[model samples]
Target chain A: MNRIAQGLTLVLLGAAALTSTVPTDLYLNWVKPGFGPFLIAAGVVMVLLGVLVIVAELRGGDQALDQEDVVPSGAAAAGDDGPARSELDHAAAEYAGHTGDGHGHDHERAPGVAWLLLLPVLAVFVVAPPALGSYTVESTGGSSGPPPRDENGSSRFTDNLSEAAPGEVVELDVQQFVMRAWVDEERELADREVELTGFAVPTEDGEGWYLARLQMACCAADAVVNKVLITDHPAPEADTWWKVRGTWVEPEGELYDASEHEIDTSSVEAVTDPPDPYE
Target chain B: MSERTTPERGSAPDPATSLGDTIAGGWDDRGDELPPADWGRSSSSRRTGTVWLFALFITAMAVAHAWLTDDLTGQAFLAWATIFTAISFQALPFLVFGVALSAALVAFVPTSAYQRFIPSRPGRAVPVAGVSGALLPGCECASVPIAGSLIKRGVAPAAALTFLLAAPSINPIVMIATAVAFAGQPEMILARFAASLLASVVIGWVWVRFGRADWLRLPSRTHAPNASKWEVFRESMVHDMMHAGGYLVVGALAAATLNVMVPREWLMAVAEAPVISVLVLALLAILLSICSEADAFVAVSLTDFSPTAKLAFMVIGPIVDLKLIAMQAGVFGWRFVARFVPICLVVGLLSTFLIGGILL
Candidate 1:
């Protein structure tokens, strides 16, 4: 039994290391794209654990058997084969209900069926499936499609650039228009739009930006958003909800603010309930 | 010389007389009748050999898989490894808990305890048992054995059957997981709860009206309420662990086959309407036999389908997947499993569709 246990453990471990070359039947075709890598890790763990468990059980059983074998043979010849009873054994002999004694219940020991688990267990380890990908992403569009579009042609923004006069209260809702004042339409307030209302989130460039509402079909876990890069602006504490009505500037190319220096703009007030909220 | 037995028995205290006196003393004479002390050792060795043979078989298969799949593309290798690991790791702790619990139930609980929980009226017992499932939480794989034990202990068939169906779904852990999976979308959770509850209740009633008591098998012995819980627990856990573990292995293999053989690109080509949607996913769920705990993660990833369709997948897989059907068949009679699975599948499908449509 010990040799067999050892042999079994070694073979499984070795199998875990062996790379299967069968191309067609090995990998699943319909699995999600990124799911494969994770599957492999899981398989290796399973194979190792399965072997460890069997080996441990085998060793434990062997030791118990060895101890039983050590009982003196002379006692057997004297017609006393059972082990010497201990005081603890007597104490422990509280009459528990019948434990498998004379129960006619036909519970068959599964001698061979347990091995059946191996085939599938091994298969899953060997043929790790892939994760969901672009197809899934693309298929998930609806009234739940991309975020709500602003009337100003931008799909995910608060307001187009609109220059506000100094001390002008632009009265921003933070949910509607883009921040910048640009294009042929907003040519009136171009070059100085200010203070929009939204959440303060970090931009991809590691700088602070005011990112506004975007509705996702699912939960916030998959929320898509639109951002307006704010430079020369005092960083609005990250994740703080604030209502800012700042001058919108088209700036030069696609740059967010023309104020080169981080805008230490004033009138950054935190407010609740922006009207006409998107999402 | 102490009691030279045989040939007048050397005044061995009249071995057959005195009735109960010297009960242990009588065993002294019997013990010497054996050829040797090592008689049982050979049997133990044989059993050990069998266990090893099984292990070796598994190892050989693994080696074959590795050799055959060695040439798999980088994507393929990653795919294989990730899925294997996820299932292996994700299911281990739960399996351990469930097996241990089942063992405890068997070892400790008295046969009559099952009756205590059973309702007096057929009319009353069925629904109570069905709804009472909220109390015990786990997968169907674990539930079947518990249900079987109850049946053996004289639990009302209808009630036990209801419990068998509903315990896996109505449990708090599953409900909470469903709620979180949908993420703030309470509607999905609501739909699931309503659908599952309705389906289970319906099944309970149907079982009461039409069930055959003989369909289920009972354990050989009746248990006393005073039975030691720990002993029962150990036995149940060991027995059930083997059964559930065996089924899980079956499921994983089938899932792997579907995963490897079916191309994702081709699956996407299918239509996404309710009919096509239900059919495809139902088939997949049947074939894949993913565990109920992990099915949610899989559901979240099936982005191509409607929320309603995915709901059907989740609801149906646990109730009537290929591996589950097989396990049920093995434990219960095939005739019983055959009738129960299809009924459950239909009910599961219809309820999921109706509920998902309204909510999603």
Candidate 2:
């Protein structure tokens, strides 16, 4: 891309980054909610820097597109109908000299793949995807049965907080619930009718479906899918929100099969998608 | 796109036509009255092209929104998009910081500053750079360009590589995160720090010893003398962003794809045997391409693994990974990465094993 195009892109990038984090939690779909303000500031700086470059280019301050690209393309310098200008338009095509096809813009120095950077920009600015679901989990093979953390490690949980008091149907995080059900030898959750929340997802094995919650340990990149198989109920329409009252059942299938962890359904209720989809 | 129709730009005497002028002075003009064509190069075409592309991209997004609103393919695409955008968003601040710092070094920082602090010898420079990395709090994504700038600035390549390897792995933010992730086991943090530092210095010396200058592809350090310092600074920042941002996308794509595609079961399966588990976790670290500051949480989550294996995971991750590989390929060419990655991996794994064996 030309310096002008690069500057405009930076300006757009800054605007996108800043807006994604502000006035709403829209950015939460892509990043941690806590990271919003820093992103806003970065966006602002990028915008300013972009403006600086644009003003410089407008004054013809920049002499060359870049000091040195791997392969300096069509250095036409707009000189007397330099035919090479057409060849230079493939900004990113020069990288590794991969494909010489006329795919890039007509800028001599702009990185050709520079256009691909807009893919994410368009994605965030437009239809922000929801948190990851079971499909990602199944595809990544992250459904590695329940972790063996039998000992509850939530520093948030205190001694007096014991199991669901009587039959109150205590609500639990799907992650905590799964961990407790699988290894809580005390059978703390065995007889308790616990409330759980998540969107419905199709099971990978095709035998059943799961009520799954996607958790982001860090960012969306590190999203972990925590699932509880709903044995008695067919999966609700994909990604439908539900609040279920269920009892933990003995796992079935191979010892290591993640699908073995099932929830015996007592009741299932429809709910709107929660603001925070992760545990 | 606007350039296509600009007849004025085509009519101007192309300074670049003469190979001598293109080589000596790319855009520098000796004439008193500037060519109107110079203005054409920066004219309405650029703005119009940007606006046109902007409208096209938005229309495409609208179509995508409709498709995503109703289809599963849209959902899958969104999943991929979120991961992709999250990476660029996260890297922006670091990119800003790095470019500003590199630009400041070029503009304000004097040659005396390097003479005063940095040693010329590779043996001493490697340690100095490795230790100085404690100062930078940015991620590996930020380091590639900064390292590139450092090399362009005349710092020894080995020293810059040391800084590159050390900054993301041992910086305070990363160390603290490692501590938090491995809380109650302070020793894991120590092991990671020592191992990562050791790995870095080892690799640096290896570069000093065996690295061929021709094999490393670097941007020329030449500067346009006529450009103002502010102009230079802005150029530095924009140039680095454009070059690094593209590869960051590539790296992020690999990270996101590998993250979902690599079965966690396989990682967990090999957790029983210590030797195999160390290799497995180290390989997983390369695949995960997670930020070093945040990887501790991931390591901690793998509860069944031995602490040594976790150390291997943390040490290897920042120094070498799919993301780092992509960035390296972008900045230094594939040849450099071909030789550099295997060497770093072997060194990173070996150091982690030795240190973890003793410390854990």
* CA-based DockQ, model 2: 0.22
Model 1 is docked with a DockQ of 0.07
Model 1 gets an lDDT of 0.49
TM-scores, all candidates, are 0.53, 0.78
Q: How does residue A6 of candidate 1 score in lDDT?
A: 31
lDDT of 1 at B22: 21
Instruction: Write one digit per residue (lDDT tens) for candidate 2, span B1-360.
Output: 222322233234232122222212112221111333544544344444554565555556556656754564565676776677776677667767776777677666655566568798877899999998888898887888777766655577788889999999999999998876565677888898899999999999999999866566654323444556776677767766776777777878888777655667777788999899999889888987887767877787776788888888899999998878887766676778899999999999999889988999
Q: What is the per-residue lDDT of model 2 for residues A100-192, given as tens digits with 9 covering 90 to 100?
A: 222122223456666666655665646565667656766655453335432344442322226447877778788767666555555566677
RMSD (Å) per prediction: 17.9, 9.7
Q: How large is the i-RMS for each model, in angstroms?
A: 17.1, 11.0
Error of 2 at B167 (Å): 1.1
